[model samples]
Target: MKDYVIGLYEKAMPNTLTWREKLECARFFKYDFLEMSIDETDEKLKRLDMTKEERKALVDLMFEVGVPIRTMCLSGHRKFPLGSEDKTTRERSLKIMEKAIDLACDLGIRIIQLAGYDVYYENGNEKTREFFLENLKKSVDLASKKGIILAFETMETNFMNTVGKAMEYVKKIDSPYLGVYPDCGNITNASKSLGEDVIFDLKKGHGKIFALHLKETVRGKFREIPFGTGHVDFNEIIKTSYEMGVRRFVTEFWYTGEGDYKEGIKFSKDFIDRKFEEALKDK
Candidate 1:
């Protein structure tokens, strides 16, 4: 039996494809599951409003295709962040959080990866941080009520660029529903900027880590970097995270629309598979 589950981020495939097509592609790529993306865009945001029938259809499609959407990258808060200084935006953020939790419950998604940011595209201050923490507690309460896991994604911003920083908020909330699903690439970049050890930072979260985003990044770049062309040491990161009790992983990359994305997907899956195989060898 496999020691772990590996999933592909939905954005790793072209957005032009339907959910069925995406799940088919994920299965063809030999991925265990698909990590759905609910980014800040209106098109993605509207998915939260999907009807019960549509949700059931998608779930049925999963069983038929054999590739379930087990996780969600809920980055919608990057636009309507809970820590926004504006009252209307904060209210919208809470509403979005509620809708996202409800959607996760309907979709049978176990974990929702939250963007670790108090405020994006706006100046952050103590007030924003306070508002963010306040709303975050409420959000966790909602997730707890539904028994859905809400985990933070280690972002590229200094506010929460490392697993340790994410854990600070996780500890503050102190809810089983609120944990960390860190991005390895972002933490790698954060290590470079903060002069800290990536593995050590990861260990800080320890039992609080639910999953990991195995993305590639350079010293300054955090997105769309070709695997093996960046500085991230997948071998060590996966090994450390595995030892930390993380059993789920998702390859986080974007389609650049330059070459065959299928090739990219296959390559990423193979690369991560090798890493997991190496990391878990004889463990």
Candidate 2:
């Protein structure tokens, strides 16, 4: 058995495929699991309202395909941010949180990676920040009861771009259910932009880090950068995170309608596997 788990992000494949097809593709690429995406799109958001039979069918499909979705990237809050100034939006955000937790429970997903943002579209002031904290505490309480982990994803925004920044909320929430799930690419960009070291930033969330997103990024760009074409140092980042006790990783990228999308998936897995091998060889 492998010492750690590696998963593919759902967006890494074409959304046109069904869940069975996606799971087959992930298994074909030798990924240990798949990280389900619940983004800001209405289509993705509708997944939370899935009926019991639909959820059961998905669970059965995982068993049939032999690859399970072990984590969720819940970015739906990016649209209805928890710290919105409008009461209606804030209420919607909390509703999203509750439904996400329920979906995670039904799907047997262990961790839900939350987008770390107080307010994405609007201006973030002290009031918004306070509202964020208040809602965050309530979210954690819901997660704690269900025994699901709700981890912060270090986002590209200035609001919560670093693991250190994410830890502030984790510490404030003070629950085992809340932790950090840093995106290597985003943190790499944040550190370089601020003249800081990525490893140092990761160390700030040492024990609180539940997972890592093994993505590729260059200066100023946050998404869709092909692996190995970017400036991210996957080796050192993986090494630091591994030593810090992170055993789960998900390759985060998009499938931009490439004809050889399978080839792209294979290349990403191989590249990240090499980094993991190098990082954990001596440990």
Candidate 3:
């Protein structure tokens, strides 16, 4: 059977709580791993309020609770373009990524997903593409030194928004540590762009996928609906991923609403378990 891991995004917790309370909630949720977002204001290692020893103690507490960090989702390109000609933002993005890579190394995580260049349209010049590849090579080199995989994720508005384009970019990188984190919902959106079936895109892109983000999006915006409530076919995704030899998955459902977070996680766990069992039965 495949190993399914539950994780909590930083946005899932109440913002008013302290860092200790957030970590405690992750333990209470019984998650096998935790995922954190890396942005300008959310650097995990640069918390001014927590001393070095206190952060180490928190890390120890997480290990004691049997939960390890899986990845740091770097949100560098949401505001600053990694492929931009702007020197200041580009350098700042790389510095932030380097810091995140170091922190992930300290925490023993092997993967860091880069939310790639945030291009508004598909019309990317050769210079822009070259810049992207060069910057990524730099990031990949830094990550490789730390024994970490720098996985790049697709975005709605970018050069590599589709699975085919994402594959092309990764193939150019040609590093074992360089791959794609195939977001199911993103695939669904990109299908419309090509006027093709979503599952077809997923199958074609499965070989290069390093990790899977289980997302259930409704309409254009990602509302984090329950597993079966959205158009993302969980069964097909899981079956295809297993066929591709992908085992680790991160369940992400972030929304501001009336539902209880714990209950949502429980439902997600049960839903994934059933999907895996069904896949095995078919096999």
TM-score of each: 0.99, 0.99, 0.86
Q: Largest lDDT belongs to which candidate?
A: 2
Tens-digit lDDT string for candidate 3 (50-100): 456765876787677667667777765655556767688678667776777
Q: Measured by TM-score, how close is model 2 to the native structure? A: 0.99
Clashes of 3: 0
Question: How does candidate 3 fare on TM-score?
Answer: 0.86
Off by over 4 Å in 3: 1-4, 18-30, 40-55, 118-125, 257-259
What's the distance in Å from true for residue 229, model 1?
Answer: 0.7
Backbone Cα, N, C clashes tallied per candidate: 0, 0, 0
lDDT of 2: 0.94
Error of 1 at 4 (Å): 0.7
Model 2 is weakest, by summed lDDT over 10 consecutive residues, at 274-283
Residue 152 deviation, candidate 1, in Å?
A: 0.6
lDDT of each: 0.93, 0.94, 0.69
The window of 10 residues in a row where model 3 has the poorest summed lDDT is 42-51
Question: What is the Cα-based lDDT of residue 181 in candidate 1?
Answer: 95
